[model samples]
Target: MKNLANNVGVSTIGIATFFLTVVVVVLIEHFTTFNIFTLSFFIVFPAGALICGAAAASGYYFGALWLHRRPTILIFVQILLVAAIAQFAIYYGEYRLLDLGDGRMASDVVSFKDYLDVYLSSTHLRVGRGALDTGAVGNFGRVLAFTQFLGFIVGGIFVFVMLRVYPVCEQCARYLRILAKKTQLFSKQEDFTRFYDTVFEVPVDGPDFVTLMKWQQEKDEKAVRGTIQSETTLRGCPHCKTQRISQEIKVWGEKEFRDVPQLTRHLRIPDGIDLTSAFKTV
Candidate 1:
């Protein structure tokens, strides 16, 4: 439960930041004419939505990765929450700045129904609808709201597809880190055929060298002739419990080692040349 909250919290913060940025940019454009710069309001909303969507998607992806959980439902819920918060902020900010003189707060002006109506309206989707039809003088508010909502959905899908292709374990309900990995090898030979195999395992740490040697010996004794193997690994976890072990096998090869040169020849220090002077200088 704590892990789930943490993931949601991270995503919320990310979405909030994106929302704030978009609201600020929109406010700036609303107050001033970017006409001098030839930047269209139409371009601004879609581009901002795309950028915000991408940012939110990244937040969801990393949050799920950290918690080692599938993000299907989580991402959807987060997007809805973000959309609500962003709509409120955008509308409230606009009301405070523009409609306060009309004796209505942003909260009073915007409602869930308004958002729903905008999101569901198909008028904006018509091919014949031009900028004039959807401009601020027309159904521009609905169009803007819908575009941003679409951005969030598109962003979530992008992250979902990417995660599916590069899969990770979603069994553990808590955040996890790689603990340890070990490789075990096995082999067999026949007069008419030959085969080699490798297996991997994650063993709890604590057995002494002698105990491990004995265990290896026992395993070897029970194995058929020509079956030889070695194991190597390191492991740890925040909860001090083993979480996962991953393994891969390749053809065996001869052991290799690197030779070290003696360092004694390079260890000599100058014989008390300036010990007293060096200490005084320090």
Candidate 2:
């Protein structure tokens, strides 16, 4: 799963790069003097795909590393980085290619007005002319960049909330994880909750000596009638006043035989399982 997530994350970087490049090149084609690269650039799609894929792999590696620690922060950071870099490419494309001059502007580079033109401006529509212009393109471009910006922010929010979310691994060989500091099993207390008939194992400190010895004697007497009897242990949790129950479980044998082994689960709990003083018999 970690590998898959890293793959997706790195792919996102590549996707952002691809979009960034497109917005950059398109703006230049519409507004620049350099026609050489624009004419031949489409031919490089295969190359771009390969390069982007490799780059994405690298990005995935880095993101994978970063996410392991600060998942929430890294998620938003990638989105923010994509938005800012892609937008910068758009602005560069416009200035260098859209304006079609030497890519030089007499106005402030950072301000929106640097690319503004009266002819391109949409006010022409409200005033009646309505011929398509860079003003419209520029406006729409701003909208695209802003929308992506918000999406990036949202991805970050999702990661923050998911980290603490406990997924139930019910189908796993282990049944549940009690959230207590010391893990215990439900089976120990003979406390059969709603999910009975399901395979559940309690962590234990081995079977009690007296219990196992007593059961072994009973098994000898009833070998033909009801012979199968075994003893198990319960895990004692000192802090949480709980104990994980251990039960005799049947396992298939290789050649019509069997084995008995007490199993444990991946349960999480707040505290260790130990009975309260009243139940301790002390």
Candidate 3:
């Protein structure tokens, strides 16, 4: 149970962060010069599934608890509970910001943020439906700009919160691969890595992957002949759940820090494998 919560909780945080990022990234792509891949990864990824998966995992973790308490559809019930909770949070945030304490609707017509463009870029829009833009919030753009600044700070904090609370899916992945290699137990370890990398490697598309190994011939071959290394990164998500694998650039400073052989703890280089396939995981 502890393990499941830790696993799902951690995954939820990472997935939510990446998923939430899609909104900002999409808006950026829409307003800037970027590629389709960038837009797809940055904008379209549904991070909510991580939350869903976590909730499901939680139910599974407490197998007897759920079965004894809720029985018929225990896991499904837990998932619904989480869904309700998430919806409540999003709705509460929206209402807290937009709702006026009168018997009236919000100043904004619709919610779901589809009208961000209309709200943010609206300097002096000429209207067709009315003489002036009824949707206008005076000095709203400035307000939005300020909010955007706040959003980054909030997002940063949220990301930190997620990283701290969760298992650091990327980090956990390092150990999983190392363990897999050390055990050398599975027949399709190679296929597993390819799929796993697609799932965990710096994603370009959700930036994606699952089924650890599918038994395809190409996937099989790629594993056995692949170059190996314990890849350390914070980058993309492909088309599956992601582990944002970016390059960990070491920053220099005037005060030299001690090299205590400590930083290596988080990284692992497995033994008795192709050695080259460490990164690729075949």
Best model number under TM-score: 1
* Stretches of candidate 2 exceeding 4 Å from the true structure: 1-67, 72-85, 93-113, 116-145, 155-197, 201-282
> What are the RMSDs of all candidates, in order?
18.3, 18.8, 18.5
Relative to the true structure, candidate 3 reaches a TM of 0.22
CA lDDT scores, all candidates in order? 0.43, 0.36, 0.34
- Ranking of all candidate structures by their lDDT, best first: 1, 2, 3
Instruction: Give residue 196's lDDT in candidate 3 (0 to 100).
Output: 39
TM-score for each candidate, following the candidate numbering: 0.38, 0.27, 0.22
* Deviation in Å, model 2, residue 55 alpha carbon: 12
- Which 10 residues in a row give candidate 1 its minimum summed lDDT? 260-269
What stretches of model 1 exceed 4 Å from their correct place? 1-45, 56-58, 99-137, 160-282
Model 1 per-residue lDDT tens digits across residues 153-223? 56556665665544232332344444333333345433112111211111223233223322323344433
